[model samples]
Target: MSEKKYSEKHEWVELNGDIATVGITKHATEQLGDIVFTEVPEKGKSFEAGGEAAVVESVKAASDVYSPIAGEVTESNDAIVGDPSLVNQDPEGNGWFFKIKVSDVNQISNLMNKSDYDKFVTESA
Candidate 1:
């Protein structure tokens, strides 16, 4: 089974077994405007929770996409790199940045669920 979680910085992580797919939230894309570029981490690259894992740039600004949990990157979505606008078009689906072999599933518990993330976005705005 897959469970999705969100970070305070607006990254989303969906865990299915040891692999966790990570992406910026839709709210993040909305804030970023039209995304023009993306740089995904190379396969085998390791990151600690909260470590900067990728780069996403929009017409308005460039942002770092952080890892929500410690892991080694197993795959990256080249589709988003080839067509950056895919992030704005589908931030949670095809826009996913990478998949990692999660080092500690416990870290996922620290992130928010959908309802909590929605509330956080609302209260922060």
Candidate 2:
């Protein structure tokens, strides 16, 4: 597993070679409250860095999940669509929204590391 990269919008990406697994941060899930619904992107759909890639709704509100890096979605996790609580239970694990075939691996460098993201969340809160 590679080091996870984070976006200011609270999405995280862990790349393994050219494929990147994307998901919301645990902090994001906490802020969203109990997750109720999720809509993952379709396979083969391409997105630019920061593009809206998925939709997640909690009891509190609905939010768009963005791709931290430009890529073509290669897989979507249906488990979260069936049981949205999975995101709340494990936001950074099995709850991952999708995997993408990265269009530019270099884009990963533009995102924050875990420590930086933790600090960002702290200061922003």
Candidate 3:
């Protein structure tokens, strides 16, 4: 299994070769509260880094989910959309949003590692 990487915007990515799995972090889900709806990009759709690729709506608010690295969308987690609460229940695992065929692997260098993300979450508290 690949380790998780994080974006300052609160997204996370798990890279496994050229494919990357994406999701919102625990902090993000907690901030969003009870999730109600999720909009996932169609499989095979392409997007650039930092582009808006999905939308996640919670009881607290609706937020755009951005692409951490440019890539072609390979798969999406339909289970999470059908039951959005899974995002809050398991933000880092089964609650993953989508998978992407990485267009630029180097873009991941800009994201945070686990320790960095932990520090970020701590400092923001």
Candidate 4:
């Protein structure tokens, strides 16, 4: 029952009930160009919308990954940390960053759907 959504900052989330699996979008990874390292947030950590939740380092630059909605991190993807190339290889799939138990599911209404996000990306470019 998860519906995938995207944020303006180039992150995507798949919300299922109270849990959301989050990660950078494919466009984001392409922009980053060969990710070298990543730091997933610790479990049990709570963050507000727009707060820094993780970090990603690529050949271009190091960037902070922001939380698109308020939630408590329930799980972190250790596989991506062990092999960062997974991010570039599969940004929307196995490369997912973390899972959060959202505090308010309604907060996601502010984000974009695939069609809107595609237009937004195109227009922004």
Candidate 5:
């Protein structure tokens, strides 16, 4: 599989075939250090673009997790619910939050690839 793509809002999506794994980016986790709790969506629930899909709570703040694409949640990382710091530890790997069966593949085209995401992050800094 290829490295994940990212959104301007600090979310990442990794596509393996039609299923997409979604999570907050490293920058996001760093901004919300020491995550303590997570409110994840129930598997099988569908959410539209920009819809609230989950919540990540850190000692510093609680942030809403938005859906980068419209899709049905297929699975969630229960490990993060028990140990939210997993996100703070590895935002791109063991820290992933959920998986979704994507509905609109074309939405993938609108997201930033690694290079573009890097540029966006740098400019926003």
Candidate 6:
């Protein structure tokens, strides 16, 4: 287990060595209302930090989910695509969108830790 890192875009990333599992934060799901659909990046796809990594549709809006670090996507959560509500029910667990083989592990250091992210969210709200 590892501490999750966060992005200003409201994505959460759990890093284990060079691999990172990513998903939108619970606050993001709450803001989206009810997630109705999801489009995870395909395996083998590559993206930069802050890139549009996926699409999540909610009753209120369709939002682009951003990557917190640059990497080649290694896996995507088919479970979330099949049952979008999982995003709202367990955004941090089974709802994780994708996993990546990070190209630059140092990029993660630029992101906020849990406490910083919590404060950032609070200050923004």
Candidate 2's displacement at residue 70, Å, is 0.3
Ranking by lDDT: 2, 1, 4, 6, 3, 5
Error of 5 at 62 (Å): 0.7
**What tens digits encode model 6's per-residue C-alpha lDDT throughout 1-125?**
57899999999999998999999999999999989999999999999889999999999889999998999999999999999999999999999999999999889889999999999999999
Instruction: Say which candidate scores most in lDDT.
Output: 2
Q: How accurate is candidate 2 locally (lDDT)?
A: 0.96
Model 5 per-residue lDDT tens digits across residues 1-125? 64678998899999887789999998888888889999888999999977899999999788899989889999999999988888999998999888999998778888999899989988988
Backbone clash pairs for candidate 2 read none
Residue 108, candidate 3: C-alpha displacement in angstroms: 1.1
Residues 60-95, candidate 1, lDDT per residue (tens digit)? 888999999999999999999999999999999999
Q: What is the per-residue lDDT of model 4 for residues 11-84, given as tens digits with 9 covering 90 to 100?
A: 99999999999999999999999999999999999999989999999988999999998999999999999999
Q: With candidate 2 superimposed using the best TM-score fit, by how many Å does residue 110's alpha carbon deviate from the native?
A: 0.4
Task: Write down the lDDT that model 6 would get.
Answer: 0.95
Q: Write candidate 2's Cα lDDT for 1-125 as tens digits.
A: 78998999999999999999999999999899999999999999999999999999998888999998998999999999999999999999999999999988899999999999999999999
Per-prediction TM-score to the true structure, in the order listed: 0.98, 0.98, 0.95, 0.98, 0.95, 0.97
lDDT for model 5: 0.89
Global lDDT scores for all candidate models: 0.96, 0.96, 0.93, 0.95, 0.89, 0.95
Native-referenced Cα lDDT, model 1: 0.96
Least accurate stretch of 10 residues (summed lDDT) in model 2? 59-68
lDDT of 3 by residue, 1-125 (tens): 46889998899999999999999999999889999999999999999888999999998788999999899999999999889999999999999999999988888988999899989999988
Q: After superposition, how far is residue 112 of candidate 1 from its true place, in Å?
A: 0.2
